[model samples]
Target: MSIELKHLRYADAAIQHGSFRKAADALGLKQSNLSRGIRTLEERLGYRLFERSNGGVQPTLAGRDFLQSARRILSDLQTIVGAANAVARGTAGRLRLGFYTSLSAGNLRNTLCDYARRFPDVHISALEDARSRLFADLRSGALDIAIVTGEPGAEFGTSMALWSERILIALPDSHSLAAKDALTWADLKRERFVLSLRDPGPEIEAILIAKLVTPGESLDVDHHDVSAESLKSLVSAGRGITVVCESCMGSVPSGMVFREARDGNGSTRVGFCAYWMPANENAALRNFVQMLEERCPPLQP
Candidate 1:
């Protein structure tokens, strides 16, 4: 049918104003154009929309039903348009983020809080998984972004250098090591260590072996299958000492204390980076990346 949205608008305006002349004035259109549009709309529906009146226009019983449907359609169209505009501006829609870091307190946590504050309408879906699974999700388009530790080797595609966090040792309150405000790798040489086989655990183990392992000396370390949360509880119960990132300090267990892990270089740390596909065109992802770049810019060479 040749009937268009303008015809529907014209009909609705005329009904609200109760006069073709007033509707045209309100719509900023010529009265003749408004009248013609209403006529076209009525003709399309094969019905008389208005009963002629000397004072003002009024909808016929049938026209009242038609106008009711027309007003609902107009309202729905307005909502659709508003949502579309918000999505285009990156102020709405969904953003799926993958990570393997503690959100207790860190740059990642701060960034998430700020982004949520700025774009409250945008839904943030976060997933914490092993590094390999995170990489796989990013590759399969299941995740828009993945924040990982160590380096910028986010295999699927583009990567950006983010902030690095200082490593810390989680010691029980009664442990003699807890007396030290900061500790060096050498201080942990004789202590028993407990680590999970999960993400940061494996990554932390690698650092431990690199720093402490030597030809003639052996360090005592045990591995378990548990989550970061459970690992902290185990340490609090004096199961064994464990290493953690600075973010873990935010919500340390009641019986545990976090001490800076250092070496000859001062504070031992692991760098973090963000990885995402360059081809993905999610507006929310784009906005998130912009915010990340602004807050944790890469070191300039």
Candidate 2:
């Protein structure tokens, strides 16, 4: 016969207190009722769990073994309950995080590190991919949340403005502009611009046109569907100069140099946001999203 949790709890309390009356008083049950419960439990196991005397109740040899197991079982059950509570409170569980390229070095990295420290029990699985794949995984429920560039899309149930990085010009070492102390948009006017043919590529081009392009003047940009690393390789070969976020400077090739652009209003920056579906039922994801909201609130207009 299977032993019930109530039986185990009753036995443990009686053994710990060493008296049925005391255990019953502690558990707020009648002494007679506690004694009868123990009897029923012992009968089911076909053993005498306790020896009674004028001194008090003491465990029989067989009762010692049974009571030890009962205590251990109760302890394990308590631990399980505690863990479930932690999950419900958003302090423990698994978080699936998806991010686009170049997030590991900047604010996203710092934010994740802080989150892991704050909620040590949360198991975060981070994946990096292109914006298209990131958004797709977020939509399909393969990912709980995603850190992507540009504004949040219509598919996102909730979104937060994470951070932004100023745009820098990536120039080849041999390029004439590399010798200059600083670069400006006008400096790039005559230069060929290389851009990634990804989600932010068009966005970056638009920003360039808005900030740097003069009225009725044409800007030449070469779009390559490649990674930032690949883009650096192309830049090192002197294919064309490209604009990138400051966070990406460390990843540039040896022969390439990143120079700050002279935009007084600081409009030459790439914005990033975190997106998640409102229907996601994961407690860990909710916790992470709440933490992100606290850390990076939306920028006021």
Candidate 3:
């Protein structure tokens, strides 16, 4: 039978009060209407739900079993409604996050840990990839947010400057320049610069060329399409020296040493930005971004 939810609720109320008159009073329903509703329900189920007498009404033996099911169904429906409301309010749901390679230990890690602690109900799944892939997934709606180095395109989504990293020179431990207290861009002349052919690679190359290599000077640079681990391996084997951020120094291979790059000024800097679709409706993303803004300092240009 196509029994409605209101019928189930009326059945539960009647059973709880054990009297049609009392249930109707509590529910703001008239006694006759409540009694008629219960009678209709019992008829649909082909069973008597209550034993009526001058002592008022009580569940028939079969009615008790049916009432138990009714109570559970009503409670479960309420729970379902509550969960839907939470999702609509952006307080719960899955968050698909993407980040650039070698980002697991720095700002991204701190932001993720803090987000998990504050919003335990929000499920977060992350992917690490190059910038091209990250932005591709972001545009296709497969990714909700992306943490990438350099500026994100306007077509990709709304971008917020998140954090910056200081450029450091990575040198072989046995290299002559490694013995120096500090090194400058001018010292890098004739040095083979090894970089990964990845998203941030081009960005980093531009920065290094601008800051270290003088105009009209040719730089010996190598770009490899490989993972971060493989990149470090190449540097450790004396393939060439490369530049990296202070944040990435922790993950540098054992044979590689990091040196401050003094460009006659201070540290040369690279920036990272958070990208999200302006139309994204995920509530978890809202909470995550809010938490990030609260916990992280604003990006200085």
Error of 1 at 88 (Å): 2.7
lDDT of 3 by residue, 1-301 (tens): 7887887888899888888888999899999988888888988999998999877888989999989988999999999999998887766778999976475366777788878887777789888887778878888889999888775457557887777777788888989999997887778877898987776778778877786677778667988987666777888899998877666755767788889887766777777778998898888888877776786567567
TM-score for all models, in order of appearance: 0.93, 0.86, 0.85
Candidate closest to the true structure, highest TM-score: 1
Q: All candidates' lDDT scores?
A: 0.89, 0.83, 0.81
Error of 2 at 11 (Å): 0.6
- State the displacement of the C-alpha of residue 142, model 3, in Å, after optimal TM-score superposition: 0.9
In the range 247-267, model 2's lDDT, one tens digit per residue, is: 676576879998888766644
The residue ranges of model 3 lying beyond 4 angstroms of the native Cα positions read 17-36, 53-56, 296-301
Best first by lDDT, ranked: 1, 2, 3
- The residue pairs in collision within model 2 are none
The TM-score that candidate 2 achieves is 0.86
lDDT of 1 by residue, 146-249 (tens): 99897886256999889989998888999998999999888888888899899988889889888888988776888888877778889999989998888777
Residue pairs in candidate 3 whose N, alpha carbon or C atoms collide under 3 angstroms: 90-283
Decoy 1 TM-score against native: 0.93
